[model samples]
Target chain A: MQSSIKQWQDWIGGIAAQGKFVGTNRLGFEGKTLKPNQVISDGPYAEVKEMVGGYLLVKADGIDDAMKLAEACPILQIGGHVEVRNVIPMSR
Target chain B: MNEKTLIQQLFKSEYRKIVSVLCKLFGAHHIETAEDIANDTFLLASETWGVKGLPENPTAWLYTVAKNKTKDYFKRRHIFSGKIVSELKYSQLNSESFEMDLSEENSKDSQLKMIFVLCNPLNPTESQIALALRILCGFGIDEIAVAFLTNKETINKRLFRAKEKMRMANIEMELPNSSEIHSRLETVLSTLYLLFNEGYHSSSQHSPLRKELCLEAMRLNYFLIENEATNQPMVNALMALMCFHASRFEARINAFGQAILYDEQDRTLWDEELIAKGNYFLIESAKGNEISKYHIEASIAYWHCTATAHNGKWEHILQLYNQLLQIEYSPITALNRTYALSKVQGNERAIEEAMKLQLNENHFYHCLLGKLHSEQNPKKAMECYEKALILATSSSDKRTIQNHLKKLR
Candidate 1:
C-alpha cells in the first residue's frame, strides 16, 4: 500500500516536473505538525496515530492524464483505493 | 492560485466528502474513529503533497490515504483479540462491496437519517437539535449559540450531554417505524423550522443572512417530502411556509444589516420563483380535509405575500390567526393574533385580548401592547415601550422600541 502511494506520488511529481501540477497538503491532525503560521506547543504526550498523514494536489490537462498519474499511486500496493473527482471552477 | 488559498479550498470541499464516504465503509457506529483517521489522512496529504507538489488527482490521493488510515485503525482495534482480528478481516472484505454500493442517492439518504437521529425526542431537549445541527449539518457551536440566544459554553455542554445520551441509549442508525414516524417527524420539522427562522431573522452583524441554514432546511424538507411515511399535510405546509419566508429574505434586511420592517421592504426584491414554488406547495398542503397550525400559518403568510398593499386585508389575516389560535394557542400565537386584531378591529379590541393573556413579560408582548396603545393613549404607549426596553434581549430591539417612544415624545 505504501509503495502504491509512493508510485502514485512519483507519477504526480513527474507531472509537476512537466509543469502540469500544483500540490498542497491540508494539516488535519492538530498537534502533529507545526503549521506554517502556527506556534509550536510543549509536550502533552501527543498520540502518533492521531497525526496527520498529509495529501497531494495535482493539476492536469485533462481527466486522462490525472487517471494515468493516479494509476501508479503507492496506496494501492497496501490495499487502499483512490477517489477521483473534478474540481468545480470558481467564478471570479 | 496561491498555495495557501488553493489548499484551504481543496480541504474545505474534500474533507466532509471523504469522511462521509469512509464512515459507511467502517460501520456508522465507528464514525468517531473514522473521522479521526480521515483527519490523519488529510494531515498526511498536507505534508507529502506540500513539498512534493500536488498530485494529478488530489481527491484520489486523499482517498488513498484515508483508506490506509481506516485499515490501520481497524488493525489497532483488533490487535488485542485474535477472534476480533478474524472478524475484522471478514468485515474488510465486506466493506469492499459496501464501498461499491455507496451511490450519491444512498449518501443523501444516510445524511437525512443522521438528521432524524439527531432530532430524536428520546434525547435531551436542550442539546438534541443543536448537536444534530452541528454533527449532521456542520454548524459550529458559536453559530448555534447565537441562534439560541446563549453562549458557546452552554451550547457545548448541551452537545456533550446529547452525545452522552445517544451513546447510553445505543441509538442505531435507522428509520423509525410507521407508528412512531409522526412524532419523529414533528421533532424533525421543528428543528428545520428553528434552522430556517435563524436564517430568516439572523442576529449576527457580520452575516445577517445565513442562506446555508435556509438551504439546509429546504433540503431536509425535500427529503421529508420524498419519504412516503413523512409526506403529511403539516410537513408540506411547514415547507411552504419556509419557502415563502425565505423568498422575502433579500428584502427583509437593509444594506446596513438592520432589520427592515415588512411595511418598508421592497416587494420587487423578493424572489418570484421561490414564491411560485411556495404557492405550489401551499396548494399541495391544502389538498386534504385536515388542518394543522402549519397550514394556518402558511395560509396567513401566503396572503401577506400576495397582498398588493401593506394594509391590504387584516380581516383575512385575523381569520387565519383565529384558526391558528384554535389549533395551537401558544403565547406567540396570542401575541401575533393581537397585532392582527389591532390592525382590523381597532386598538380597544386588540388591547382587550392582549391584556387577557399572561405573556412571559417578554419584550415582544410589551412591544405589541405599546404599538396598540400608541394611537389612543401616548402615555400608555410610552409606559409599555419602557417595559419592553427593560425586557429587551438585544440593543437593536431596545433601540426600535426607543424610536417608537420618540415618535410619541
Candidate 2:
C-alpha cells in the first residue's frame, strides 16, 4: 500500500514537473451510495466486481498526449490498465 | 545424461561446492568473490559443454577451470604485489594456493560451516534465508525473486543489505564453538524448517517452484545430517517431517490445483518410498535422548502417512499434539490439533478447544469450526463456512469453503 502511494506521488509529481498535472483523488474503500427513493447503500462498485481505484486529472494538448501519461501509470505494472479520456467542460 | 541436463546438474551441485571452497580459502568477507568465480565457471562450462559435449570428468574439468580463475583473480587484484607481498616470496609461491580441492569431505565441511555462518543470530531471519539461497543453494537473484514472489530489485536490495550485515559482524565461515553450538544449530534448523514450510504451506502449493523450494531445504538439511558434528537427532527428525509431508505432495493437490482433504485424497497417490525413508530417519532420530518439537511433529506426520482415517491414527496424532503443545505452543498448532481431536474424541470436545483458540482472523479456524458443527447444527456449520469463505483470500481456499457450504445447504 505504501509503495503504491509512493508510486502515485512520483507519477503525479512527474506530470507536475512537466506542467501537465491538474489534480487527482485516491478514492477510498469507504463511502455511501444514495439510490432512487432515498434508499442508502454502499458506494459505487459495491455489487460490481470491477472498481475504479482512483482518478487522475491532467492537461494535455490532445488525446495522444493524455494517452502517453496513462501509459506511464504504475497501475499497468500489476496487470491493471488505464483509460484516457478528454473531459468536456460545461458552459454556464 | 544429455549435455544440457549435465550442465544443469553441475550447476546445481558443483556451483555451491566451488563457491564454498573459494569462500573458505579466501575467507567469508570475499563471498561475492567466491560467488563470482563460481558463476563464471558455470557460464563457461555451459558454453564449452554445449559445443564440445560432456567432458570425461565434468567436475574435475570445472575444478581445474575454477583454480585457474582463482589464480587469475589474485593476479588481477594485484594481491601478490600488494597485501601479501612480504609473506609471499618468489620461491614460496606455488599452484597449491590456487588448488580447488572440492573433495566430498572438504566441500561438505565448507558447506556445513557456511550454513552456520549464514545463520548467524545477529542477522535477521529473512536475510539469513536469502543469503543461504544465494550462497548455499546456488539460486540466481531472479529465481530467488520468483521464489519470494517479489521483484528483482527488492531481492537485490535485500541480498545487498544482508551481505553488508554479515560483513559488519565479521562472522567466520566455520562451525560455532561448543559453548554456542546448540543455539546456533537451532537457528540453522529453524531457518531450514521455515524454508521448507514457505514452499509446503504456500497457497500456491501446486507450483513447481514451491516444490523446488522444498527440495532445496531438504538438500541443505541433508548436508547437516551427513556431517558428524551437526547430525543430531533433531536434524533427522526434521528431515523425516519433510519427507512425510512431501510424500503426500501428489495426493494433497488435485489436477485442478485444489487441495484434497486427508481422508478424501487417493491413498494410492501417497509415495511408499518416501514413507519408508521417513521411517528410517524416525528410527535414526530415536537414538538420542532429546525429544525436540521436530520429533513430535515427525511422529504426527508419520501417522498421517501410514494409516487412513481411523481412531488408532488420530489417537496417536492427538497424543503427539498434546506433547507438541507442551514443548512449543503455537496457535496454528493448537488449531491443527483440533481436527485430530474432533476425530478421536468427538466434535463437541474439539469444538470446546476450537472456541478457546478464538482465532477470529484465521480462515482455517472457521473451516475447522464448520467441520465440527456440520453433523449437529447444519445452519451453524453453514454460517461457519460462509465466514471461512469471507475470510479466505485464496481462490482455492474459497472454492473449498464454498463446497462445504453447498453440502450443508
Candidate 3:
C-alpha cells in the first residue's frame, strides 16, 4: 500500500512540476448540514458511502482537460471516483 | 514531517530572504510587487507539495519558482523591455541575473541593505519599526498589530504610508555612507532593542509567543553583527544586552503565566548557554574605546547573572547604573538606579531620591516605593502598595501587588 501511494505521489508531482496545481483544501469532519426542516446538524453525514476527503485546484484549459487531470487520482484505486466542476470567478 | 508543516516552516525562514532579493532587483518602489511574487511562490509550494510530497531541494525549488514568477511579472507588466530595462540600465533582467543576484552572498547583502532602507532616518520611528517587523521579519499584519497594541487596519495603513514614502523618495536599498553610518547604526540598534523588549514584555496572552518575538529580534541583531562592515562596538553591546536578557526568559514567568520578580525567579531555570553567549558578546563589545548605554546596561546584567549572592554585588550594579544614567536618562532607569542605591546607601536616601523623580503616575514607581518603605514603615508601605495596585494595568502585576498586600496583612 505504501509503495503504491509512493507511485501515486510521483504522478501528482509530475503534474505539480508542470505548474498546473494551484491549491488544495482538506474537507474536515466538522461542518454544517442543512435539512428541509430548516434544521442544521454536524455533517458530511457518516451514512454516505463515499465522502470528499479533500479537493485539489488544478489549472486546465477546459472541463475535459480538468477531468483528464483528475483521471489518475489515487482515489480511483480504492474504488472511489472524482467529481470535477468548473470554477467561476465573480466579477469585481 | 508533513508536507504542509514543511512548507510553512520554509515560508517562515525563506520568505524575507526571497523578498529581500526581489526588492533589491525591483527597487523599493516595487516592494509590493516583490512581496506578491514571493507570496505566490510559497502558495504554489503549498498547493503542489500538499498532494505530491516534499521536494529533495526545497529551498532551491522555491528560489527557482520565485525567480520564474518574478520574471513572469516583469513580462506581464511589459516593463522588462521598457521601464525596468532602462531604469536599471546597464543590468538587464534575466534568469541568470536573477539566479546570480539571489545567490547566498547576494541574499545576505540584500537583507542587510533592506535593513538600512527600512531604518531610513527620514521615516517616522513607528513606521520604520513597523516595516522592519513586516518586511525584514516576515511578520503578518495581524502579528504586527498585536506587537504595536493596535488594530490590523492601523498597521496596514502605517505600512502603506511607509512604503509610499519609500516610493516617493525612491529610496535606495544600500548601506548609508561613512558619515551617516554612526547615526544610521544607532537607529538600527534602538529599533532592535524595541523589538526585543516587545518580545520580552509581549502583550500577548500566550507566554511562549512573546519569547518567539524576542528570539526574532535577537536573530536580526545577530545578522548585523555577523557582517564585517556593520559589526561595531555598539551593535555588539546591544547584542550582549539582548542575550543577557534572553537568558532569563524562561525564569521570567511561572507555570501559571504570572510575572516572576527577579529575586524570586529560579536561577536554575536561567539558560546558561545564552548567558555564555552574552558573555562572549560582552567581551567582543569591549574591543573599541566607545562605550554605549548598551555597554553599561549589559555590564549590569552580566553582574546580575554571575553574582550568586547579594553581597558586594549591588555596588557594581550601582556603579554601572550611575554611568548609564550619566549617558542616558530614562525615568525607568532612574527608578532602577534608585532601587540599586537602596542596596548600598540604605532605604532613607533611596526614598528621598525616588520621591524627587516625576514617575508618580507609574505603577512601577509606586511599587518601588512600596519596596523601599516596606523595611522601614509598614503604614507607608501599605499606602504605596495600594496606590500601585490602583495604577497597575496588567492583571499579573496587580496580582503581584495584591500578594505583597496580603503578606503585609
Candidate 4:
C-alpha cells in the first residue's frame, strides 16, 4: 500500500506536470501552496494535526485512469485516502 | 486543453455562479466562508477533473459539490445549533424549496448591497469603491491598485480594512429603503463609473485599456436598472452616458494603442449601435422632471457623436457643460468645458477661464495649460510642460509632455 501510495503520488506529480492542483484546509497552511511547476521547500514547521496528508491532480483520460493511478499510491497503507474528481470547465 | 485555460474558463463562468449560490446558502455574515468554500470546490475540481474527462453537466455537478461543501463547512463551524441551519437542512430535501429562490435572489442582492455598503461615505475615503470594484466587479488586486495609482499592498490593506469595517458594523445584505436609496444609489453609480473610467483609460503598460472592466461596470449598471426600486432616471442617465462614451472606444486609440485625440479619431469606427442605445437611454432619462449630471454628460457625448464635418457644433457641447456645471461643480468638468470653450470661443477666453480656477495640482491641468500657452508664448508653454512632466503619474503621459516640450525647444 505504501509503494502503491508512492506510485499514486508519483502519478499525481507527473499529471500535475501537465495539469493543475489546488489545496485547501479548514486550518490555515503556512504560506500559500505552490502552483503547478513550483518547487516545494521545507522548514515552515507544519503542525502535526494540520499537515496535508494527500492531494489530487487532473490528467487526460478519465476517473478510471485516475483511480487506477490512485490504487498504487502509498497513502492507503497508512490510512490516507485519495479521491479522484473531474473538473467542469467554466462556460464563457 | 491546458490546465491554465481550463481554470480560466471555469473561473469565468462557474466562479460567480458558485459563489452566488454558496453565499445565499450561508448567511450574509458568513460570506467569507461561502467564498472560501466556492473557491475550494473549484480548486478540487481543477485537481480532479483532468483525469475525470469532465462532467456531463458540469455546472449542476459543481452546484451539488458546493452544496455538500457548504454542509461540511456548517458542520466544521458547528453552526447547526441555529434555527436557520435547521431550516436550511429541512428545506434541503425539498428540491423545489422557496429557500432556493430566496437564496438565488439573496446572493445577487448581497453583491448589490455590498456595492452600496462598501461605498458608504462613513468608510475609508474612495477605498470602498476600490474594494467593491475588486470584489463585486471581480477585478484583480493588481488591476485595482493600478487604477487607483497605488501599490498592490496598499490596495490589499484598504480592502482588508473595508471588509473589517463591514464585519464590525454587522452590515446586513438588505437593500436600502426608498428614502435612503438615493444616497446609496449615488455611491453605487460612482463606483460603477470609477470602474468604467479605469477600464476606459488604463495606465498599464501591457494593456492600456481593459475593456473587460468597462463591460463589467455596464453589466452591474444593467443589474441596477433591473431592480424596480433602484431604476431612477439618474441611473438610466448614467448608463446612457457610459454607453455613449463606450461607443467611441474603438476609435479612441490607434493600432499602436497610443492615446488618439478626439479631433484625430476616425468617427467612422465608432459603434453606432452603442450610440443609438445611449440615445435611447437619454430619451428615457428625460421622462421625469429632474435632470441629473449624467443627463448633461450624455447630452454632451451625443452632441459630439452626432457632429458632422460641415458642423462640429461646439456651442451645443458648451451648453451641456454649462448645464452640468449648474448641477455639480467639479474641476474635471471645468477642464473639459474649458477645452470645448477653446474650440468655440477661441484659446484666449478658454485660457482666461481655466487660469481663474484652482485645479488640484495634477499633471493634466498643467498639460492643458502648456497646450494653451504653446501657441502664444513658447517660454510659458515650456514652463507649463516642465510642471506637467514633474506631476505626471503615467509614463506615457510624461513622454507625451516631454515630446511637446522638445518641440517647443
lDDT of 4 by residue, B53-110 (tens): 6777666666777777766666676754454454442445432232333245665765
In order, the Cα lDDT scores of the candidates are 0.68, 0.80, 0.81, 0.69
TM-score of each: 0.70, 0.77, 0.79, 0.71
**Ten contiguous residues minimizing lDDT sum, candidate 2 chain A:** A10-19
Compose the digit string of candidate 2's lDDT tens values, residues B1-409: 7878887777878888888877777667677888888888888888998888888999899998998888887788877445543333243445445456688888888888888888777778877888888777877788888777778899899888887887787767778887888778899999999889878877654378788889999989988898888888999999999999999988988887778987788989998999999999999999979999999999999998876566588767766776676456566777767787788769997787577565788898899999999999989998888888889998888988988988888
lDDT of 2 at B123: 76
Sort the candidates on TM-score, descending order.
3, 2, 4, 1
Clashing pairs in 3: none
Ranking by lDDT: 3, 2, 4, 1
Give the range of the ten consecutive residues with the poorest summed lDDT in model 2 chain B. B84-93
- C-alpha RMSD in Å of predicted model 2 compared with the true structure: 20.0
In model 3, which runs have C-alpha deviations exceeding 4 angstroms? A1-92, B92-100
* lDDT for each residue of candidate 3 in B1-409, tens digit (9 for 90 to 100): 9887787678768988998987777677778888899899989998988888888999999998988898788778887667766655246555336442678898999999889888887788888888988877778788888777889999999889988988999998778888888889999888888888888886566666678778888999999999998999989998999999999998988888878999989999999999999999999999999999999999999988984756678867766776665555576777787887788779997787676565878899999999999977988999999999999988888999999999877
**B35-139, model 1: which lDDT tens digit per residue?**
577568767877877788888877677766776666666557664134333333235453223232235676565655666667878765547657655665555
Candidates 1 and 2, the one with greater lDDT: 2
- Measured against the native two-chain assembly using Cα atoms, what DockQ does each of the candidate structures obtain, in the order listed? 0.00, 0.01, 0.00, 0.00
lDDT of 3 by residue, A1-92 (tens): 75564445433533443345676665887887787989777776746777788887777888997886787788888887889998888985
Name the better of 3 and 4 by lDDT. Answer: 3
lDDT of 1 at B197: 70
